[model samples]
Target: MSETPHEYPGQLIEQVRTAAAARTPLRITGGNTKAFCDEPTRGEALSTTGWAGIVSHEPSELVVTVRAGTPLAELETVLAGQGQCLPFEPPHFASGGTVGGMVAAGLAGPARASVGTVRDYVLGARFINGRGELLTFGGQVMKNVAGYDVSRALAGSRGQLGVITEVSLKVLPFAPAEATLVFELGQHDALEQLHRWGGQPLPINASCWVKDDTQASAPNLLFLRLRGAVAAVEAAGERMLREAGGTRMDNAQAGPDWALCRDQRLPFFNAPSADLCLWRLSVPQTAPVLNLPWAQLIEWHGAQRWLWAPASAAREIRAAASAVNGHATLFRAGADGAPDLARFDAPSPAIATITQRLRAEFDPSQIFGQPA
Candidate 1:
């Protein structure tokens, strides 16, 4: 490969072609903000940051096509200027987080429970498979389609299947009004309220409930953010405050507070001890609050839960999640001599077989990360 800067897709294609010819594994990297999320990979680094730029954006059409390496903050800023945004509200774990990493990580912010996830907004993508073949999937719009939508499949593939070169995403107009409310409630009460509101036409856009470890007698604070038409937001805010006994929190505090939760920078995430492991549980939205021997922070209305517990509790945690028809992942672990626990849950036999087939089809040489 030439040492000269290669900033275009054609150059990236040729680079991959050479790597494929040499049977050399290429580790896809973008802003490198999410490298801690996955296990350390073995391969030559193929930095995608060099190929960054917005390819095409039609705000009038509510679609934007951007290179995979484009920084997520830049993309969001551009959309904000146009009064449009990516409804998924992908989190930027770091200042340099990239669009490719966002999709690969497959994480969404508070609004996920209401609007949808990162994969749902994915309209199309162009990527280079293990064989160095460039392929395009789906399109810019959500038109009727048949068969599989490969673009969405690649959203959370984590560079195991291919190197995403460019992506086209569906955007939404900014809400006309927004408000945040804070309720002093217990875990059970907060969970019940979230579930009840889920069945209604409430304009709730995001929520977070966390216990205050500092004050043993202090009640858990439940933060609810409502967004939509001005009238709807006002109406919902009034109803929630009157019925739920919540006070209207300053809107100014919403952005930074949400950012902390989204990026795992909240005080709850700060480990009291280096040996403690951070676990993420994905259960049904209506699943009852877990009775565990660890502190918990509830997000995504109720589907996403975070637990700060010792690494030894991995089995028990996983079992508890399984009981609720959910899965648990070791979101973060210490480098100290911790036992090796599966980062993700084991798939069912049918899913395992299909995953293997997909890996075989996209990366026959096993040049990417471990299959499935």
Candidate 2:
């Protein structure tokens, strides 16, 4: 199929219907930047770009409805202009990752630990189910019905079950002002501090720690962010600073710092000459957490760890994570590895059964991954 939808209809319903009729698989691509996602897609690829835009925006209601193909960056720009934000701070997977991809990938940024995840903010969705039929659920208004929230299910499905064409998201007004409280402490103490804050209602956006492994002398710099009014932020920082016995650092790169943490592009991302494999580690927020000697970047308040486990020793990484009830995925592997990468961790039997059923329902003909 040519890039120009010359013969094919750019409509979401028509596209899926055509794929179903042809028995061709469909691969979904919004912004194609995050190619290092879950399993490499098979069959034909579908682009949601042509079908993108914000259909509804009620600033007062704090809700916005948009087509699935919209770029998150574009949405963020619009929301920022309105003094609002996505709250979850979905990562920019790549230059091409779209709103659809954001939900499907089910990845959230630093603030995720505090506010909520992507699925939490999704109000509803419209999609072309596996049977090539367009289905809609949820309402334009926030906090509506609970009848089979397909919108939440659609998230992280990777277009395996349906083609999401429209979405309703709950948004929040941007905080009146923003500030990050930065302090460098020992890794042990930093981790302890994170645990302590987890128990309190103290306002914080993201808590992250970075270590310089080789020297073993690197300060485990911890960062805390607050957004709202200037006075509140200042007061919170001052209180927290005194409580932790740490002072505030410069705020020059506060925003960028958060962004880098979300995209996994910090110094930790460039592990050992930028040659080590990058793994998105998901460990439970409990005792005896992962203790690595090398440099590690903590985001989502230790819920998510961007690790650099080189030599493609996935077995060691997986084994360690499994021992502690943790899960790991090789986000970016070394060049020596295979191109057909596996981004999913082991799934439970029940989940497997459910996933298979969902696949059958949204993609009876299995046309979703079929790139057009």
Candidate 3:
């Protein structure tokens, strides 16, 4: 909240040092908005909320360096003021979401498929390793070929490797034009159309297909967003409407709808029953309709799928995802709280070896809590 930056690198280092000497695991926390994201780890809390503020912003360079604990909303507001934004459109999840949590979670919104992932925009980062030593990687530039790009790896480490202290991110200017189109298409038809448009030079940015139980006449629909230069957007919008047979939604209505989809506030995201958990499937966009028996909301042009089903169905769900060369994550547990299932799929043998090596190098004593 303070205009000036609030940093405590010394205090953070000292705490880590003391914990390392005792071989104590530390759970790095920021805002705690995404605590439910991964398996909860037990350890002494290392709160990063106190280490907050924007370190620098170079609108000309399209980069911003900020302390890890700076509020996500505040960062977005600053970028909006400059007519720029984090192209990935990271999700806040809740009010207290912080920059550190955003990078750590590495979950992107609908536009992710078009722009990139959180790791793509992460230019650089600084963190405190298990040895209690502060280390920095990458820089505030688009290209840095000096050393290994370990900075981008911190994007989705989930605090397992170290406690992220600060980060430099690449931002992009807002699109000069934007438009949303709605089509009354079923899941299969919608995906077919998206794949077709994807092959062309269309300015398609984001797409969401869901069954609107509230609308009896047209329950199945696909909401597509296009953003780019004025001419491109206009041309794409007209072509899609004429050839695709859909109506253009007013910006005023579409804007909030997209936001809701980004933050999982849409009705489709709501759990119909307390026993059902939220599952996220990351598959190839061309993957066909899954035969799973559950309500689904497809996004990212069919790459990301959200479903609600009991945790007991984990085996079937995970198998279904794997068949399409994808992975399934138990994004959120049921109302009863954390389930016995793993939050993420187990890494393959090769990836597991690399992950273990990285953890050993950065966190030799395993002082950082491991998310399952």
Winning candidate number (lDDT): 3
- The per-candidate count of clashes, in order, stands at 0, 21, 0
Q: Model 2, 196-255: lDDT tens per residue?
A: 877876677778887766565666788878776788778888888888877665667677
lDDT of each: 0.84, 0.74, 0.90
Model 1 segments beyond 4 Å from truth?
1-7, 144-148, 337-339, 370-372
Please report the TM-score between candidate 1 and the true structure: 0.95
lDDT per residue as tens, model 1, 244-349: 9989978788878987887888889887778888899999988997878887899989999998788788889999999999999888886563546667889999
lDDT tens readout by residue for model 3, 181-219: 999899999999999999999999999999965457757
In model 1, residue pairs whose N, Cα or C atoms come closer than 3 Å (at least 3 residues apart or on different chains), thus clashing, are none
TM-score of each: 0.95, 0.90, 0.97
Candidate 2: regions farther than 4 A off: 1-10, 146-148, 213-217, 229-232, 273-275, 291-293, 339-341, 369-372
Better of 1 and 3 by lDDT: 3
Model 2: what TM-score?
0.90
Pairs in clash, predicted candidate 3:
none
Model 1 residue 365 CA deviation in Å: 1.2
**Prediction RMSDs, each to the true structure:** 2.8, 3.5, 1.5
Candidate 2 residue 235 Cα shift, in angstroms, is 3.0
